[model samples]
Target: MNFERAIIIREKTRLEQLIERFNSKAQAKFYIERSGGDFNFYEIENEKFYESLNEVQKSISKHLKLKIIYRSFLPTYIFTENDLIVVLGQDGLVANTAKYVNGFPILGVNPDTERYDGILLKHTPSDMNNLIKEVVKGVFETKKVTMAKAELNDGQTLLAFNDFYIGADSHISSRYEIEFKGKKEKQSSSGIIVSTGAGSTGWLSSIFNMSHNIYGFNTIGENEHQSQINWEDEKLIFVVREPFLSKVTQTDIGFGVITKRQTLKIESNMPRKGIIFSDGIESDFLNFNSGSKVEIGIAEEKANLII
Candidate 1:
């Protein structure tokens, strides 16, 4: 292969996580059983995922230089520009890895087709040879996935591949002042979800689904897939989940589109437990307390996924 190395990113399987917590497979099973969970399903899922991973590893070994990495180490890991990234897991794994890799050409490989409906994972292990051949010849097709950037006035920033959740860390309401397109409001809701085209089908889509599925909701002339934006779409959408209407708070500026020109600005009124987490990674979140301001917009950096 022309590339120096391919970084195969993966997540810890359910079984692995269970074993890590309990220290042994038998202990994990016992714990699951005691907790009224299905241990058999866990064992089967782990076995299938490992088997698929083995097949993928064997196929990728012949054509490319590969470096295997777990998802947990991604934040501290340094990725070179010349390296090719291959994430061997479900769509969430692909989204998690995309934010860290900058613009490296990432190939998403589905380890178990039956287990995961990986919309982001476009290739199977059997297709590895052709995919590698095209990449080495510099003839690969790429999707420039749009990403959402959350920047604090303090200079801290985080990129979201699927979407961004800006709100409270607890069950209580998130308090914030949201301004967009010269319109502003004091909102207290569950949170604000800023979604990119790439993320529309992810956490973003579920929001629409939940709203659309409401008994009397009507999406009359709108194409249902309109919320499922293309990967390269330049625009972004933000929704304030469950905005509470009261004397002090207004829902007028609750939802809108964030484009290349205009942006969404949020001022946090929460004293603590306020966070901005991307793609559902709760641990890797930014603290958004009182006096914190975040600007949400289209990120300059895009994810290049080899299709």
Candidate 2:
């Protein structure tokens, strides 16, 4: 496959967002300093990001036609097979870009090594030139990561690179009917989190941490076992958050594994405020109100990250 263009994906720096909100850089600085915040920190972060972004553009331009796009436009952006994706930001940016690319090879570039852990960002700006060349030659390696999918009965769907949160938008309890492996129950709880193998260490691991800290929690053994899932594993793990047991509800069917052969089904009972969001981006969500049923399973498509 001959790649013809490199699409650079980025997000606005914190300083930029602040400036937009305050109407000017000076005003933004004043607001932050007045609030005891380090105004210089935001300035430095913005400077370093643009500096790294400029270096990436220069290097990629030597190999393919380069185009820059803000992360906000990703939903409406049309990508072609001839495009190579270059994502510059923290690890979350890579996760945000993966679902929209349809398995296109993504090179994650860590703009600020000091600030971000960059678990998903394997390359730096200096590595772009050589990496782009290898990708264009089709000689590069990619780690195929499994993703989770939520398909509603009405045919609406959402993909999650890390995990999907199915519950109320607010802090109130979410009421739903959950079914897995022939067992079904009606419950009221915080929500349900369905995570892919790549997402095992993220929101899913935090749940395990909480469970570990709680004494006499028998679920610690199961949490430890599920946390070791690999990124390439074609499976998903679903856990019910704080499943409350009452005379009218059951908590027996709260946790399970999802696969090609098995799936977790959920039907919302909330009259309003029910939603399903993926990868921590609540803005891009599916309305999961009453009468909406969704099947949570392993997505057929995967995220192909350039390694």
Candidate 3:
């Protein structure tokens, strides 16, 4: 196994400790970044985080020869060569796991064990030292995850670690007609969601009115109203256990499902005002006036995860 390119991804507070622990055993590097930007709130200042990172870098430079990098965004750099990676924070773990899928075994260290849902990491900060020792001793396992891919009408393609969403923009309703394999269905509701196995827990689960599963989709309509459904056995099944009625027409809202082989199409009158979000992060708004078509499908490339 190659041990010269060991990379450690962690938060500011735990950088020094991780570096000191792994530097002697393997060639190690560190990455640090500020948290809390996705929800439009700033948790830490850039200058403050960078200043602390610089101090940590200097301390590590005194004892080891390695590079210290900064991660400013999610889905950090892709893996080019085989290496042992030690991740130290929740965001770092999520970002690194989403980006690096090339059969590298990752050891996740939970800096804050009690606060967040560290289900993926599942290891305490105190366990970092032991985890590194185990990693060097070849004592661990890795898991694989699937990714959803989206291809637009313009031949542009994108990937999602969790799910791909096509829906109305914030505060605006969307009206579209759907076509599946030459069969047309007019949908005057919100939008559609296509998810992979890893994304089956969140939106998809809620839409189907069931617990987390392997693969599914969720279509959320306007005004917090939704019609949950799933595809199975060459047919789509809609769950109407707790049925809902449309407020505008007072008609029982129905769920929908389309076969996998069917070519599903969604065209909106307000396509420009509508939007498409992937994995709750990446997004692109459509322009109906320009007459663009948004196409989505299962991706050929799947994500590899170390669970």
Candidate 4:
């Protein structure tokens, strides 16, 4: 067993964040309970998460060099080729880490299953040790998850594990020219959602559900929505959110599927406030104001998840 290192990625607990913002846990509890929230549940959830992370850390350190990293520091932290990543948080944390990493095999752990769905997290602290042993012995299996990519004309690029949002920063409509499968149209919409196969069951599912309710579009059945996606599928899906019809702007090209051979392109028409962000992280984004053109498609790189 010759693994170089293992990097454990964890997000700050709500309790820790409360202390950071309000200067103490007592103040945070007072504020939450006063506002009719469950402050007791918060404390219990935080304690379970910390204990799970601690146990996982101790087990990994016995076999390989262990490094603990916070989710906030992922962008600046350098990853090595031999590093095995173990994410201890929600499903979104795994998705967030997938974009920044190259091909490191990741083990997703749900520290507190009560607070999370753990759809992407297939392991618990009790089982993490055995998985690490298998990984180090080169006997673990992995699934390759497809990712979405957005590239601007000027060469800046962003990758998304779940989906990408192309629109304004605020509630204002986003104005852009949409081109897909050779047909193009000018549109003013709430935004555009570009999703990978792995993300089809998430944000993309909500958009389709809305369409079904509004237009009686039941082409996608309740069970089939998730059936359409495979983690390793090399394709992409996009839907325009609430496109408005104008005399000049059209709504014919509001939704479509993108593939390796096919792509979706958008040219920004808003003078200001236009932005393109991925994986729900709005703080880190690319300007998509007037004159900016972006191409959305399947990313060349894929995320590997240890099973």
Candidate 5:
């Protein structure tokens, strides 16, 4: 594909957010210091982020037209196949941007090497010039990442690069009727998490860790082992969080694998406050209340990350 421009996606720094809330840099600093926080850290972080962003702009602009957009504007941004996505921030920013890209090639750049793990950021600012050239020439390589989808009966839908959380918005139990492989059960639990292969080591692995320690055994044997689901895997894993067992609710159908052949179906039993959020972004969610039903499955679209 011939690329015409690069769209840089970014998020506001912590200091910037503080300034917005307190109305000024001085006020933000005073509020943080008064609370016994290190105000200097926020300033330094903001400085480094912009410094890296400047480097990225200088390099990529040499090959294509450049435009910068904040994360808040992603939902309404008009993206085309001719645009290359350049995400510069923490790794979560990459996940946050993937669903909106519609399979466009995304180059993840890690701005703060000291602060972020950069699990999805494979390139640094120095690599931008060469990488942009390759992308424009259609010679760049991309790692295909699978995603999960939640489609509501009302025609609304949500996508997740890592995982999807279906449950209540608060700490209260989520009541839902779940069906898989033709078996059905009513469940009352913390919620349900449907994770893609790229997210296996994230929130999903933590659950396995807690279970293995509590049970004193692993899936294979007494020796511990962490399961790995590849980024390209077509399957999904769903685990119920703290399912409650009683006369009306059961915990038997708490865990399973979801595939193209077998999709997971759910119906909300809660009167209100039920939600379905993706990639840990609560603001971007679908209402899942009573009389609402959803189908969970592997998404037809995948995140194409430029590796």
Candidate 6:
């Protein structure tokens, strides 16, 4: 499909440069501001930032076919079919980025390059116009990123772009009775992390004390795999880091797999108090006493990123 319309998502600092860049190239129809309400720090206050973006939107609209839209807080609108979505924010905008632009190939423009991790975004604002041109012209490659889907026993379903963690919220260690396919096993560790290939370099790598290979976890050499479990049953592979212990020391940490299973269930000892999140956003709270079960596996659909 030909993407005629482009959605520009940007913060206040990069507004002028982004406008100039967009105007010089593609004809953007919608200007979406990276409002600071969803962010944790460095927020541009409601009065100042909105007013600034509003004026800039008007100025850009005068020259090109652009309509400036703003939400007093974070926006909840999903992208229209075949719309090109761009995100401009630091780490705090990760969840929102994943939520709004799931199926679409999202291009992230890092406004704050020094502080940002640049996990989702591959480039900065200065290089965005060329990237967008490449994307619209079908000259760029895309990576298929897998996502995790979780279903609680109460019939609640959630999705994670990174990993799903099950463990104690309190200082006390929590035990989990885990079942893979039909076989059952017990884990007495502080928690268990079910991570996606994209998340392997983040939380999973940290827990395992390994370096992240951005291409994917499959590229890791066999020698490295000996220390970690890199086997794949299908699209989903299970890796357990420092399992069966409340506290782990480098000398005692070991990794294993829960076997190749299409469906896996985890019953937490402290069910009601357990937490389930996707890419750091909490989706639902586990109600253990009422027989809560968190099922983890590959999502039916995958995420596509514009690289």
Report the lDDT tens digits of candidate 1 across residue range 1-307. 2587778899889899989999999999998999999999988888888877777777667777788899999998999876888899989888889889877888999888888897899998878877777777788888888998999999999999989999999899999999999988899999999998878877878888777777335644467435776778898999999999999999998778898899999999999999999988898789999999999999999998888
Taking all chains together, the TM-score of candidate 2 against the true structure is 0.97
* Per-residue lDDT value at 139 in model 3: 66
Q: Rank the candidates by TM-score, best first.
A: 5, 2, 4, 1, 6, 3
Error of 3 at 305 (Å): 2.2
Candidate 1 ranges beyond 4 A from true positions: 34-36, 215-219, 223-226
After superposition, candidate 5 runs with Cα above 4 Å error:
218-225
Whole-model lDDT, model 5? 0.93
**Candidate 2 lDDT trough over 10 residues, lowest sum:** 219-228
Please report the candidate that would top lDDT against the real structure: 5
* lDDT for each candidate structure: 0.87, 0.92, 0.48, 0.88, 0.93, 0.55
Q: Between prediction 5 and prediction 6, which has the larger TM-score?
A: 5
User: What are the C-alpha RMSDs, in order, of all predicted structures?
Assistant: 1.9, 1.6, 11.1, 1.9, 1.4, 10.5
Better of 2 and 3 by TM-score: 2
lDDT of 5 by residue, 90-146 (tens): 988999899999998899999989999999999999888788877888987899999
Over 1-307, each residue of candidate 6 has an lDDT whose tens digit, in order, gives 4565656565444443444656831222133324322322223332343443454334333323432232213245656656666555554354345544656776655555566678777766556545655666767776666677778878877666666766666555556677765667666665667776666666776764453444356777656643222212234444554455435322132233332356668776664566665566553334443256787877765666677
lDDT of 2 by residue, 232-258 (tens): 988898999999999999999877889
Ten-residue stretch with the least lDDT total in model 6: 24-33
**Runs with alpha carbons beyond 4 Å of true place in candidate 3:** 1-3, 8-78, 85-87, 91-107, 134-139, 208-263, 282-290
| Poorest lDDT segment (10 consecutive residues) of candidate 4 | 219-228
Model 3 lDDT tens row, 85-199: 5555564345335543454565554545444566556565445445545555556666655454555677656665555666566545555555555655445454566655555
For model 5, give the 10-residue run with minimal summed lDDT: 218-227
- Candidate 6 stretches greater than 4 Å from native: 8-75, 91-96, 137-139, 210-261, 283-290
User: What is the model-wide C-alpha lDDT for candidate 3?
Assistant: 0.48
